[model samples]
Target: MKITVILCYAMFLGACLSFLGGCASGKSSASRVEVTPFSCVLAPDTNGSVCVDVVFRVPSQYLSRRSRLIIVPQLLLDGKLSEELTPLVVDAPIYAKKMYRRKVVQNYQDPYDAYTGKVEGVSGGLELPYRETLTIPLGVHTGCVQAIVTEDGCGGCTGLDTVEVASVRNLASLIQDTFELVRMEPTFHEGKVEVLLQFLINRHEIRSDLGNNRSQLKKLAGSLRPILADTLTRVGDFRIYGMASADGSRAFNTTLARKRAESLREWLLKELDIHPELYTRMVVDSRPEGWLPVYQAMVDDGHPDSLFVGQILRRYPGSDDDVQEQYIRRLSCWKDICSRYLQKDRKIECAYTYTSYESVLATDGMWIPFPIKQMEANNQAILCLRRGQFEKAVDLLKDFVHYTPATMNTLAVGHFRKGDVKSAEKLLRKVKLPEAFRNLGVLMALQGKWYEAYRFLKGSGSLNEAVVALILSYNEEAEAIMAELSDQSPLAEYVRALVTSRLGDDVAFEVHLKNACQLDELRLRAAGEPDFEKYREDKIFREIVK
Candidate 1:
């Protein structure tokens, strides 16, 4: 059979090849090439070339001896042809005699272009069932692009097929990181104390208002006045527990305990003379017998008889309360135990919660003052810090502007937040405070000095420290610090996902990342984090980070 071709290039249209059905040459004209639809994946190489991966196939009996099949591919970028991407030639040839029989053959051809462009192909000249991949190196361009592939027979003598390639990009996404600045602010310490007032057995009357006891009562009353005045202190809750010794009948002791609690409340209400208008609610309760003190006293006493007493208390076994009491009282050291351990039990316990006022720097780094002060003096730098204008804060604190350890430290924090780590480190070296260590740790972490960061982060309980610990794979330490945070932000959740991922807990990591992605900022942040690069291709991970 002889192959006849009609070649006509109209605008961008392809050409055609025609073969008469029968000829005496014994070659079948029915053999026609079928170019399967194909696609190209464009990935950028480090040396500034876009990799083009094109996959296509030709049927086994399609290649004829008269026709030389070649695939011509041109890159279309952004709806226009890329001038930098020259046309690539992909070909598969068959010998005429071999068309009648199927045989295994392998061939590789690195086709060279006039433009010196290179195309990578499999080790076979398009063999039968010409399924092959051609990886061509094209000039790099990030614009939306596709390949226009044309299968031509007999070089440009005839055009058999044309197809536009659809594509999926495998470009390496860029990472743009954003850093959060840590604020150096004053901190307040909150604490509570319990006051104990002892009473004679069975007597709820006032007595022993002398020595330290008088001072204690005075302090309680004075503390209440300040709290009520709402000046230096704010009271939270007041609880009075009147506890009685575990001696005598349960009924009598219960009544005695109530009386003692009530008596203490009355004395404070009447004698201290707090304003009647104060809406303070004091929770008053009575405990007729508390076994905690008895048990603790026995453990502390460490006597041979104390062991027997502990055994009796633990092994008494009966559900009857009176029987248990009688069984313990029958011990040989009952009187001594009663006098030593039970004496302190006949008392009114006042547990009051009050918040003392102290000026602490707020999130904006400004001191929340009880009274406003002029800013020209010591507050100018503070104002700059509050507004997160770190450059201004640095300028205001430089040299003669301010000269205290705290001022220097604040300036250091401002410098660190402003990306001036060297200056921050120099400033930190001149100071010796917990804040210095914390800031240094954060600075070190930012610099990727994991071990150094850990060294400074030790014994620190800041959120920044926790995040750094997580980044360094100190899971337990990070968890401990994270647990203490009253506010959990998206960044915190992202850090949690990182920690969970490091711990090999995929379920928890997914759970945490799902929560992190719920916040828009964190989801964007996750996309740029290299820590999750391993999971970037995972379905759930791609969904979350996307």
Candidate 2:
């Protein structure tokens, strides 16, 4: 009974083989299929898509005598199928004959038999070669190419089987990461304050009770207090000018004016405690008041002789103060003018110029005045930029003429962060600073110009530079940069994780990713990051993301 069963089994196997058009002597092996460009990378192209060159080789006798081989190429993103290329089909003699009979003689069509290229009459030793360039839309961060092979037996004698023939991994994609924010250096600003003190006629000394002298000196001192209180401020150009009324002789008035200026200068030196060096730098001058002030005061007061005084002054424009004063004394309202406005010009005026070194507080995304006080226009615009107020910053900077290289860089950065790439590039082109180059690199990266970004970010020594390096597959350089980076923030840790993963350091990648996932934002980013797709099912990665 056992011998009969064995004989029956042998006959059935032989019949099956014969019905399948006779199996080849050589065994079918997936190793016979070859794919070129072992490391599949979807690089960005100028045509708005990522394209790759693909070549497939099937050695002789790779297909069975009565079988059909269908090869489909697919692009996988994050381990999920993204795009599929046209299939390449090859059929043995019997299978090709059957397909031809079904389609032509029986007038039947099979939708499942769709293919781009086909090879019929394999003859048990035919070799097949397929080569083509495949394309897909850009912006995929990570992806790989895989070739799937499907085998269909002749007349159902053998069951269908599918297998992965070839694949390439470590596809690169654009990285979105934090950029550098440059801090502005301290700037120099100048301010001036003046105080006018009226003096009694012909008098050289100051009378505190006269006119508004006491109040004016007090106000001037108050203004000086704040300027002196700040160590960053330096006061200089201490100048005192004395002008006498037109009532006295030119010689007498000039001497009186000089004495009046000296008296005020001495008072300031004593009261303000002016340093000896500053005192030496002080300037004192004297002048006799011409008839202009008298004429102006009369016209303003609507005096009857105002026009006459103006006529005389204009007629003798080149005359000295004495000649002009003599002509002005003849006016009918001269006395009135002396009482009202002449006394105004008979005064000692003190003026000083100061320079202040100003700085601001700069954070990641916001800037504040260092002392929490009102800032100048330029500094205010910087604050606006750091706060993401792009329009306001542009408005403030557009018409401003005194832009430093640093301020120009700030303006460019504002435009870049606001999605105005053209404007940002135009402005950055004019700025010659390392910060500007760094910003340009980031802009290039954002626009899918990885090579340009790599060039611009080279030697920047910033995390942004390292990220660009990683995206360009400069693994060793990226690793070296990460080691040099001093940033310990979650974003920095996340970038470190990316670098380690690309370098095949799985343990370090997990550690860095865990550290970065502490932040909810980073965790969410990692959850969808294609670079971390392989780790999505990892126990520790799942826990970290969850």
Candidate 3:
């Protein structure tokens, strides 16, 4: 009986030792917890939450009486961890020496007690297959969900076991500027042809003594051929204001003026082979004796008689037809006046408006040629600029001089588009053109000079200016400017949508956003814009951006 008691005690002792050893060696740290492949999904629930499900497997031996499982979850966006979600705590079975003999867990409390304490569970040979569903708000940018599990068991603990839950994405820009229309107008050339014809005294007939007079008439008539051939021409009256010399009687001189003008018109028509009907409408009028020419000639001759001539003209001022000439012919300067000036008084002056066409072939696009050859380079550069060849445009304009305000403005724009804002601003200071103001405003807005940008952009009526206003939170200004945009460009409307969204005008926002997406034709760009962040959870916003 004594021997049997001793053997039974030893057996009990040995069994207790074996049980304690098993608990101490509880599945090596590597096999403690195993999580299956899981990932965060982009499926947004009706509650504006993104759902992610994960499965964890805890081996039977890993659940010791003193051990607990703590899971810390975090969302990583663009490789950065999110701090919004709370960590999860799940306690496991603790197999104490006395509790092992009972074969049942005691004091099993829910791990979510919100306190730091140990919980108990049944000490069974069954493995734990756990599944959990985590809901994260859709507002968070979650590229991946990470789960870090650590066992709070024996004196020493297992290092962190990390599981990555990658998120799935199932969802799917004009630098707008104002352009002026190019217009081409026909070129016009204007000139006058004057003819001085001589006639025999008191006679309306042409004289042989006249030198080169016929040749002069022929030259004048021939010049009209080229003018008449122009696409557009306006022929003025062929005027012949005839005058008489001071020696002739008033009545005879008048008759001679009229007859001489008529004879000259007839001769021109016959000699030039022009229609007589056209000459009939020509102007032929008689004027008083041409005394002004005689006075002017005496003054121009610088003769000693000029002082006496001026005194005589000023002393005797009469409106009579030949009074002045009558007195002048009696003076010593009379010969100088008649010989130099009276001969020039008998003349015909002809003038007409002529418009010609010049064809300028553009390289491509809607570029027009510059009016002057010096600016041809600028024209070509503008063409290149319109085609988005900024570097080529810059190269073409590199050596260009004679910069007009328009050319400077275009070159500045090219430089701005190339990210050379300093150079662009330098050129802009030379001109206060509206385009220059708008470009400067755009640059200022990019540099975060909001107030300065507003100052420059105000009243510009440019779509880019409106965009800057919207970005700077100048709602009233943005709305006012955007309303004036006739093109309703996608970028402009998109900015309007942002303004409306801020004002809580959902209907208008939706309307504008829809139009923007339609015109722009790409939803992804809208998705990346920060202005729409608040609407990320809205179904309409999602649909449009997607």
Candidate closer to the true structure by lDDT (higher is better), 1 or 2: 2
Best by TM-score: 2
- Runs in model 3 with CA error above 4 Å? 1-371, 388-392, 400-402, 417-419, 519-522, 525-546
Against the true structure, candidate 3 has what lDDT?
A: 0.60
**What's the CA RMSD of model 3 in angstroms?**
19.4
Q: Model 2 over residues 1-546: C-alpha lDDT tens digits?
A: 999999999999987875465433323465356655444444543333544555655556556656777777776664688778767777766677777899998898766576623566454344445555655455343356677766575444433333343332222333443444455434444554555767655567877787787887888677766765676677766677877657668788888888888887788778777677877888988866666766777788888778888788888886777887777777777777667766553556666777665643332223443422233455777778768788887776666444555666777777776778798888777766787788788777767787898898899878777877876789899899989989888878988998888778999998899999888767765775656768879888888888
Pick by lDDT: which candidate is best?
2
Give per-residue CA lDDT, model 1, range 224-266, as digits (tens): 5555566556556677777766667777777777787777677
Clashing pairs in 2: none
Off by over 4 Å in 2: 1-34, 39-49, 64-68, 74-85, 90-114, 120-145, 153-174, 177-186, 189-423, 501-510, 519-546
User: lDDT for every model?
Assistant: 0.55, 0.67, 0.60
What digit string (tens of lDDT, one per residue) describes model 3 on residues 259-376?
7777766766766655555566677867665455566666777667777767666777665546655676788656666566566435654555545544433322233444344255
Clash number by candidate, in order: 3, 0, 4
| RMSD per model, one decimal | 14.9, 20.1, 19.4
